[model samples]
Target: MRSIVLLASACVVTTSSSVAAAQNPAAIEHHLRYAVRVDGQPDVAMDLLERMRSYHVPGVSIAVIDHDRVVFAKGYGVAAFGGSKSVDSTTLFLAGSISKPVFASGFLRLAEERKISLDADINTLLKSWHLPESKFTEREKVTPRRLLTHSAGLTVWGFPGYALDSAVPSVPQLLDGTPPANTAAVRNDTFPGARWLYSGGGITILQLATTDITGEDFPTLMRRLVLQPAGMMRSTYENPLPMSRRGEAASGHEQIDTPVPGGFHVYPEMAAAGLWTTPSDLARWAIALAHSYRGERGGVLSPAMARQMVSKQMHQQPPYGEGYWGLGVAVIGDGDSLSFSHGGRDEGFVADFFMRPASGRGLVIMMNGVAGGLMGEIERAFAEEYGFGAPPRMTRTIVAKSASELGAYVGRYVGAAGKDTVRFDVSVAPDSKTLQVYNSAGRR
Candidate 1:
């Protein structure tokens, strides 16, 4: 909403402050209650917030829209690690795989124009390329729809990317399981139109196909079809820090030994892993999703296609159902009150988007700087708050070890003094076992 630039430390602290400021009525503190119907709302909302915060998500940006209105939008924690910048509605964040469903929406738009066919195997559209050979399966039938829905079964989470000074694979090399891929070839992992598997590589191939077929760069395509139409102005498909434009984005951090700025280095794959923007901007995208479900022309996608996008594509795991996979969005359920969502995470970033078509409620959360996998709990909280489903029960496993073994978990936290860290050391004697926490700041 505003043209603003910030340094790392200040960016992290202040961004969240603006979103959670006292003036904001729909702050993240009560995000769980935004459109959720529960027996006791206020108390439950407070507890959910506590649990989310308790999980060590340093920063979180959440947006809740109901019935075409923005019911809640708030930011939490620091956007830039060791910086004063806070999470706010205006802060830009990497939305990881969330961009996939959005990209799928673009493909659906082209399909509507009869420019492409979802059922058509993608081999025909590769500009100067074709699917690589696979000893495991036939590749001729691999379709764009299957790739978008992850049914085409391409392997690899992504390129795994080479850094600024490192050698990265070219598009074909990456797809062909060449030197950089170092794994399965670009050939179909599963027969086309079969089961679902989450493959960032599949999306990457689709990018090549989409660009070749449409004659546009990925950025131009996304902006023209999805960003502008959906009103996501503050976003872009550009992933790495644009040369000469480095300061425009919020930096990320990691907390393994100490809080380090720009966590895990930069990743090179922009299509499957790039795209950055604010929750406020994404909120509009969520609203567009809400509109699409309600028979409104929210943007690039038709209403029918929009519904198809969020439906389950494949059964990813047991108890998760044969999750609907239309286009890119992984639809988890079709309950009268809720539809499941797909979330994305990268080295230094994490994001989640939930659309409740049944109730006209949509939510998205983004965060920079992570402690560990605990960041996912917030998404679970959002679902539970809305009565979408019950949170899974976790069982902790305790192991015994020697004192020397337990002593290895020691570390000093270089972050702000108050931030707690999680570290455990294990040690034991032949007669019995012992556990010692050399350094642990955060409460578990």
Candidate 2:
């Protein structure tokens, strides 16, 4: 069982802290800290190494963008735990769902060239396999626009990736859910263009359609259209990575000490989740996208297409929060506060990147472990250090309670709202003054 410390807040408040206007890259790296700090302990900040150890993350790579340029890129810890090989700016990690926005950028380039229409029925461009017709597609056919915006009502949220020793399925076979394919057949489960529901299955379909239209493989198409133009030389959509580049790849970790079998998994669903890249390369991609958005010439996309790529296409209300879904990224805030962001999670890797194109400021953090929460901590640190706005911190005061008082609040609790229901279990600690809470998922 897991235990979590419970804090009771007497009041809620939001306040911004002021930071130095200018800092060198080395100073910024030295201040790579945590969001939490004791009220009276200004010097008590958790450093990157301490947090990395606490989160069981062996390696972390970071890139910071300022004024539409990459200010600095750095890596910390070893590529694999218990190994001497240290992580550096060139170490590659799986970008996971981060591949979507990158792929979307290339797809938009094709649309700009008049090779494919965003509103056309995807099945029209699909030659090898077709999206099986259903009642959902009777009135509104699935289009590339809806797929990119995640309003196409497709099923299968993600891919699990195959072990290195296993046979990987072709994109078509994976879409058909045939032998060697571990996922279900891609299908429409709800009315088209109804609402936002993420579907990597839809992306796999686009991958096939893109190849069908261009007569070029997905990796080759992306290289020619996006990577080469954006200067992301260290990035690739090639699954299992190429043998010549394996030396630069970081191993995936299941935990602080546990490593994924055979070092890493192989993803044939390249468009959905297979992207091997460095944080520095990702930073360049973001910078290039921002340049195109500003009407800069010689970028991967035209200004008009880049603007559409970052515009809000639909509203997304997840259980945790609410946001707007752009073509391939999540749009946050509005006007001067507007930013586009995406997070990725593979079997043993987690990554995230956010950019405020208006201000030309952003940060990318990629980890070679399943420390998803740690990425948020690092983002908050960057915000505090670099003066970018971050999520509000909820500070609370600790209070001591009697054993009987704590016992009164211990038990199973249930709550319901509309069609949703939640369950939580609370118990008193051995000391009797503290309480531990567990959610329905058995996580604390």
Candidate 3:
């Protein structure tokens, strides 16, 4: 009986809402009604409701932009685990590192206003705190261009954020890795402009710089420069959203659909992971960027500056494709077919947005779960359903190899991960059928 109760409670009965899709009802209905993906040889369409349940995600909100407009923006499932509030188009979710692109846009807007220079040394604009000098900077200085491109050589890959009621640390404390802050010190890990290495820490520096230069708080500055202009009025860089706004926000959850005690975490690292927003709002921002990229009048950036923002700053290796990190967005594909995108992950929340700058077609998906595999599946479905070509189809040839050859690759190794050392053991099956890898704890 207990198992039955648990199973019943775990089941998801999601019904999507098209409150924001009224303007483009047909397009929205078509997208919500059908979810398609390739099943090896043929196309398979699954019910959106069932997919959410199968993935154990509490809720999801999506906004699809096409032909320079948001054709669909809707939400599915409950806002909280075992709760009644339904997620809708207006539901706010953490944008995570997606905050970077928005923040980068603000930076460019500030540049247009002549408040800061992208190529200038960032230390010149920051007054409250400055990057501590290191061997990496002796020959080269960190700039907004490098920082936004993840070539700043800074530390702290990303922030895990703080609990809702926990004491939040100041930006300086976070950068210095002091008390009340969880991550390590945000410092130089390599020479500046050396390569592409993601650093929420580097963005944090920009956050501070923006504040110091503008003489305004990060959120307020962003509103004046980027969000308001881009028509993302519902978005804010504020962390731990105001009490009044909580009701409109989706509560976060674990992969198992268990509610986080507090609806969401408080990300004081606003530039890196803090942004409470809706998919519809993000879609608007994407549309504005697309317009600006085509040398048209955009809300915040000039055409030339917008083009520069999406231009390749550095080359990124495979797994991300022959990708390139632009100012703050990932540029994929080439020439007229290029697209810009970014993914965000915070405790109990995950999100991503993709847009074709030239074509004005893209989608944004936000969910309140730690495990985000469902987002990718939904994206694949969107690609097929809406004809957004180039969903990553794996194409590899399997080859048979001798047992001796496989055995040679099997070995034990040790490596340092953060402050702890870990061991890994690689072994081939006795029957020579497969290989298994084990971590320090020995569980595969």
Which candidate has the top score in TM-score? 2
Task: Please give, for residues 369-419, the per-residue lDDT of candidate 3 as tens digits.
Answer: 754446656765565455552344443344567888888768876654322
What lDDT score goes with residue 154 in model 3? 85
Q: What is the lDDT of candidate 3?
A: 0.77
- What are the runs in model 3 whose C-alpha is more than 4 Å off? 1-43, 318-322, 394-444
Worst 10 residues of 3 by lDDT: 1-10
Cα-lDDT of candidate 1: 0.59
Over the stretch 1-444, how does candidate 1's per-residue lDDT look in tens digits? 111221111001000111211233343354433223334333244443464455445567778666556777777776565567776777777777777777777778777876677778677778857876565345447778788877775667543444445566666776776775443555555666566666777887887877787888778888987889988887888756565544445555444323334433444455677778777677687677767866876645677877777665555542223335666765554455445466665656777666666566566777765533344444444444443322342333456566666555433323221112223333333444553322243333
- Candidate 2 yields a Cα-based lDDT of 0.80
2 or 3, greater by TM-score: 2
User: Which portions of model 2 show Cα errors greater than 4 Å?
Assistant: 1-20, 23-25, 28-43, 402-444
User: Which candidate would rank higher by lDDT, 2 or 3?
Assistant: 2
Instruction: Give the Å shift of residue 205 in candidate 1.
Output: 0.8
Q: How far is 39's C-alpha from truth in model 1 (Å)?
A: 18
Candidate 3, RMSD to the unseen true structure:
8.9
Best lDDT among the predictions, by candidate number: 2
Residue-level lDDT tens digits of model 2 in 85-138:
999999999999899999999889987886677999999988888899999999
